[model samples]
Target chain A: MTQKDKSILMIGCFDTKEENFNFLRQCIVSHGESVIAMNTGIFGSTSLFPVELESDLVAAEAGESIGDLRKRADRGHAVEIMGKGAGKLVSRLLTERKIKAVIGMGGGGGTYISLAAMEPLPIGFPKLCISTLASKDVTRQVGMKDILLMPSVVDVAGLNRISRLIMRNAAAALTGMAKVNLKTDEKSLGTIAISMFGNTTACVNECTKLLEAKGYEVMAFHANGLGGNAMETLIREDCFVGILDITTTELA
Target chain B: MTQKDKSILMIGCFDTKEENFNFLRQCIVSHGESVIAMNTGIFGSTSLFPVELESDLVAAEAGESIGDLRKRADRGHAVEIMGKGAGKLVSRLLTERKIKAVIGMGGGGGTYISLAAMEPLPIGFPKLCISTLASKDVTRQVGMKDILLMPSVVDVAGLNRISRLIMRNAAAALTGMAKVNLKTDEKSLGTIAISMFGNTTACVNECTKLLEAKGYEVMAFHANGLGGNAMETLIREDCFVGILDITTTELA
Candidate 1:
């Protein structure tokens, strides 16, 4: 088995989600995985938990000072600068092969900013958002990325019965996704890629069975924006030996 | 005496600072001044206190669906749209005469977003930010508005001994600022306005003493960007009977 660093990149408005995030951090740490806290909140210095990448540093990454930012007192500018900074920081971390996954927590503004930060990461990297807006159509937040939106059934305000359960489960999901390893051997059939959606699921299922029976490996991609983007990205890397297009809804 | 509503507009990223905000709310409420919670956190809903303005509504006011904004997952855009929305919302509230004062708390993004919301309020509206960046120069955050910033000496993470004290004091400050009955009558001398900074403080102070001796109500305005802007704004409204131009650094 190859060595995989279970280092998770956790980002949030530490200026806001301190308690919830602290719980998540503790849960993750107890499970034997290290977490890197990238704070997006620049309110003050009395952070509830220790942060490796403070908002000021993130602001600096975007070519601004936290003091100047406070002076500018522009919310939209803060979001943009932090987003750009997070992207740059995330990109650098990816290049250095430091983080195995990404997870964020926030309501609307926090969700948007953190997810925007995650937008630049390569596909198949585990990305998750425990949001109050998760049950709602999150296509706007997920976009074309493989970001997993877990609905936080309760408000992420104070520590409560439901919030603790939801947060612990989320922490587990990220760690599990990051730690799981599925090794492929050389003797397996060459991989064949297929696109499918609910409307054409039966046809795609039949095609997959037929391909597998013919001694070829098959993998199905959903026709949603995120799935289509994933398929295209994987295809660019020659991750498939052949392609069978079953649904064109993502294009049309 | 003119009637001024004691309804204070309290805005912040409640997603994390629930305990602190709740404490402030209770303090404000107990003091008999109604506090309006203008929520800046768009995360989940387990808010410890009630908010009059939700971030989703703020986003909608910015001309974007919350769902679409979530999908776009753009932080900077979130900040801009929210800022614009807060500006409009605050302006409407001011027009309707709904709020008497503004109070905000958060680290970076929260402070910026909240201050941006306070930008449209006129001079002497009593704007404040309980911020982490308080010790640093906040000319940018305060802008030209009459916004007062109280430093959150601790991180506004949770209700520790220190955080509790700062937040309570901040709450009291807002309530006090809002409820003060500073009834001015017609017998006072004509108001004299002067602008000055450290380089001209001694000169301005000396002049103020002389003016007080001469029976004029002398008010000195610091020549910082915000102060200069405020001086200009107040001057525009015929606030000064006589202008003593002590410093022109804002113009420079």
Candidate 2:
């Protein structure tokens, strides 16, 4: 699917990452792509850019009011509140097929909010996070999602040369990943998803050859966590007609 | 309180990260700390170093056999199987106080296995992962746990200068962290936990001054996710007599 068909949802804490988000949006837009900005910043009501979904709207989506959040005003609580709001908003966008990819950039607070929003998207939807916490242990920020995190060499404090280079590269790469079209053969063949590994390589190869000979398509899943998770996601989407389970070791 | 009182639990896929783990073990040992090595590798039956807990034992802990896994031979499946096994083993060790820190070093498979083991650890226990995927998106590898990840700049294919430097730094840091003994004043003052943020800084400062005047020890939780989670954990462990939740933002 082309990115032109779907807008990239850029989520960030506008209060903290206003400059980063603006630069990132410009980068994405420069690549012939459109953007939908969400203000996930907890401390502010207004943003430098036109934020379509304000933090207050996001908070309301999470069953809270930004006004109430400000009244409370604890950084940790703000993160939780804004994170929930943004997450709910992103989930709704995913369901409505309005977004092809989600790009989030932030410091600790921004990273927490952005990643939380993108964590619920299924595989194949491009999810990218450019953050200060990119190099830190983000096991909780990513969970089991295919969220791609590009480490910002420096802190997301100012628009330094290093930060700009990293952010630019990440934006281009993600936009390319989101929009790239894979050429498909016009011929229709019933596709099959086959799970394989090095030990079972020969067996899978022979099966694939035999399947191809009979006008059937074969897709191999390496059985790694990413491969396994992706295969399941594709299967759930009804993208594959049959499955040849050669190795079920992960089940062990 | 002392490295002599606790041993770091070192877990890795011996088949993939045998050399790295062995080196890591040596570094920690050089710092006068001991290591409990668990081979979480799936491909091999033995390791380059003496592995205290074998992959067979780990698999069995997850209700499977390494022999069966070898015959089936799926790398992805092996990772999942060993991850579960290692996770179970590590959890038990943590509960039994057999380990003060869990150190895992590996490439993709090894990192996966090691991180899976360390994920179940609570807040206070020091958890570290030295991995090739350290710079990559490690959100899944770290989860919500307090695991620290050190990026091995180069691949863990050999004992190169870069890898050695990183491994050494990570080892020394973790050891120092583990062995640090904060000098006690021996003064009996009841401790209080205060959750604060920039917005509540003035209020918290006043409160801290008043509490200290009343001869109460006050510790402030900045109300970031880490700080808030830590405060909750310390509270759960009965580490505080009173809690001043001035900023309730995280509750949103």
Candidate 3:
């Protein structure tokens, strides 16, 4: 896609970390890419863009807000409701092709909300997260996607030397990725998709080899949910010609 | 845990269906107040002893049979490695606490090496599966802890009607949930663990008010990986005084 078509979508609880968001937004603009920062904070605060969409805009579009939908006594309900709103907003941007790449930074709550937004994007659409929980097992957070996780060495409590360094590097990374042309020839090879589990490896391998020798390229995926989902995604993209699902074990 | 303390663990490869494993063993035996079954099949088959201990000797293990593992390989060093040998075998099982629960089942591959060996057990352990992909989504397969998914429905290909029905029901409903009686004088309110997705209404309202009135307790799970892990299996074991978690978002 052209640079103009490659819009970088920056999302997170920017109200809590306006300084870092500002820095990242500047980097995106400087790299010759446009940005749409989706602010997921519950209460409004100053934003880099006056026209930035807030959670209320998301709720309004969805026809609900955290307070309106959640019980006053339950904070978790509010967070979950807000996360839904954010996910909807992000999903819209992705569907409309307004966002070619997405980046977010946050702690536990914000990470939860941001990931909710990122999860709906197609695989390999350039998803990145700079989070305090990056060092931990993020399989749950990143799921089966190609989301890049950058460890925020310091707590995201506020802007600091560490925050600046991390955000700058993240911004640079996404900017470069967004600017690059990743178009591959669509007619190079007809692909076959296969699913296998640890128990059924031998069967799939034998089948894959047989297929390869016949001049068919076989793409194998683990039968785990993400693995299956990834293969389906590629299939949906029309990247594969046929499917020899030998090890369809994990789907069970 | 020590090796002696370690038990023979069984996991299901419910990628296809669950008949063969569930019916292999029958009759539930009591080890103290808990009931245990030997077979891992969930819907089609019925087991005499539903729970098995790690110490007891059993015949088959999920990822053990080399012949079966070979059949499912696709390509790459990782695929070959995962298909054969026991690379992440121990850790993967340990992460799920298989030695602690030892639940498994499948078909040709499912029965050839998946559930037979899991037969011999000391007592007071977990083992279950209801393959046929076990009727769609399988949060139940993982349950609260130490369970494996076995693929038996589609390709494992063999079995009668009774076997399939028994296996499905067994996998979905069987808990292997050991009931332990404790003597306690101290009484605390109960806690509810709620799972929330961005889309539910009833969960958000009922959970909040209930927790406040009873002052019993409330914990909200985000319906993502961590949230599901925290609420469903971990916190449910009385980790907290009480639970009121109603919002379940990511089950789909």
**Best candidate (score: lDDT):** 2
Q: Report candidate 2's fraction of native contacts.
A: 0.03
The ten-residue window of minimal lDDT in model 3 chain B covers B178-187
Model 3 TM-score is 0.46
Candidate 1's displacement at residue B237, Å, is 57
Instruction: Give me the TM-scores of chain B across the candidates.
Output: 0.74, 0.72, 0.27
| Model 2 lDDT on a 0 to 1 scale | 0.69
RMSD of each: 19.3, 14.2, 17.3
Error of 2 at B215 (Å): 48
Candidate 2 per-residue lDDT over residues A127-243, each given as its tens digit: 668765764667656654445566553456545333455566556645654554111111122478788777888998899889979977677766755456546655664656788
N/CA/C clash count, model 2: 9
lDDT of 2 at A49: 67
Give per-residue CA lDDT, model 1, range B26-126, as digits (tens). 86686677877877666644457777888788878888766776688777776667777887888888777677777788777777788789877654455
Least well predicted 10-residue stretch by lDDT in candidate 1 chain B:
B180-189
Question: What is the full ranking by TM-score, best candidate first?
Answer: 3, 2, 1
lDDT of each: 0.67, 0.69, 0.49
- Assess the local accuracy of residue A210 in candidate 3 as a C-alpha lDDT between 0 and 100: 94
DockQ for every model comes to: 0.01, 0.03, 0.02
- For every model shown, what is its TM-score relative to the native structure? 0.42, 0.46, 0.46
Error of 2 at A38 (Å): 0.3
In model 3, the runs with Cα more than 4 Å from the true position are: A61-63, A66-73, A181-190, A197-199, A213-215, A223-241, A248-252, B1-252
